[model samples]
Target: MTRVYTLVNQKGGVGKTTSAINLGAYLGVYGQRVLLVDLDPQANATSCLGIDKRSVRTGMYEVLIGAAPASPHILHNPRYKLSLLPSSPALAGAEVELIEVEHRETRLRDALAPVMDRYDYILIDCPPSLNILTVNGLVSALNGVLVPVQCEYLALEGLGQLTQTIQRVQKSLYRDLKLRGVILTMYDSRTRLSSDVVAEVRKYFPGQVFDSLIPRSVRLAEAPSYGQPISTYAPESHAAQAYDALAREVLVQDGIPTPAFETTR
Candidate 1:
């Protein structure tokens, strides 16, 4: 079965694109065929994987509007051996255009159906806001949702609204939609606040938080500028190791076998 997850959080700057890119790369390293769907109009995930948004004439926007096929729009990342359905700035306008389209919410679900069987995992990097595009991403998620929450003072600020949106989607669209797990990102062990935030989130969600917490690293912040995932940009960095562990945990949770390898870190 293909495990499709939407990396989403209504709050911006929470490491959603970073987690989606690196996690998909690590999953590919662990012998899983992964396809990352860049659903955000910002196209950060597409650029992070070495694709220039300006050069991408056909992308998720075209597929969603029925102007192009999803397969032809997918670009392969040689570094991670993972495929990507790139996003462009034009996707920002899709919200208004899709409003009048029939079955707009499930457009992405229908677009991805033909390609679902081609990979073991399909990860969607959603936009920061909950709009038609984000709803499409959520509707296409077959496994569940993976939220990347930053360790900061306002960590739980907009979480209530996000949960309410998920519940509404589950009630109306996807009944099997679930909260897969919460990944704590940009954590600094040196800061006492990081620990406090983690504890509070764990207390709120209990068993839903992931064991692999992503640490704050300069390399992680730099990788996207060079259009590469942390695994390829700085494999020896702690961020790379953390994402690798996250991939293992995801596989284990899904009853999939993890590849055994000695860690260089």
Candidate 2:
């Protein structure tokens, strides 16, 4: 069974793309075949994986509009040993184009159906805003959503609106849609604000928060510039270890046996 999860959060600059990329890489390191779907029009996830958006003739935009097949858009990230459904700037127009289309919300779900069994996990990196594209991501994720919340002031600001949106989707679209877990990212232990935010989020969600918190690291921020995941860019960094632990937690949550952690050092 493929575990499809949308890394969603309406708030921007919350490490959604970073988490999606590194988490999928670590999952692949743990021997799970992972597919990362870049649903954001910004195409950060696609470019972060070393794929040039300008050179991508076909991507999620083409697939969603029925102009191309999903398989052809799928690109392999050799460094991470994972697959990616690249996104391009043209995807921004898809929101308006899909508005009048029949079953627009499920277009992504339908597009991914043929390749669902080809990977052990399918992770979608959603845009910051809750738009039609984000809705498509939520609809395609049958398993649930993995939220990356940054540890800072106003960290929980838009979470309520996001939860309400998810509830609305669950009520009308996917009943099984769930809040898989909350991932605390860019946590700085030296700052009091970081600790307070983590405590508050844990108090709010309780067991829904993952045990592994991603620490603030320069390597994490720099990895994307090099078009590689933290596992490949700075394997010995704390960010890499945190994501590795996160991969184990994800498997354990799904009742899949977690393998022993192997240091990327």
Give one digit per residue, the lDDT tens place, for model 2 in 1-265: 9999999999998999999999999999988999999999999999998888988889999999888889977998666898999999999989999988999999999999999999999999999999999999998889899999999998999999999999999999899899999999999999999999999999989899999999999999999889999999999999999998999889878888765843322
Q: Compared to the true structure, candidate 2 yields what TM-score? A: 0.97
TM, every model: 0.97, 0.97
Once fitted onto the true fold, the runs of candidate 1 whose alpha carbons sit more than 4 angstroms away are 261-265
lDDT of the structure predicted as candidate 2 = 0.93
Give the Cα error of residue 87 in candidate 1, in Å.
0.6
lDDT of 1 at 188: 96
> Could you give me the TM-score of model 1 versus the true structure?
0.97
For residues 63-158, write the lDDT of model 1, one tens digit per residue. Answer: 999999899888886668799999999998899999899999999999999999999999999999999998998998898999999999989999
Whole-model lDDT for model 1 versus the true structure? 0.92
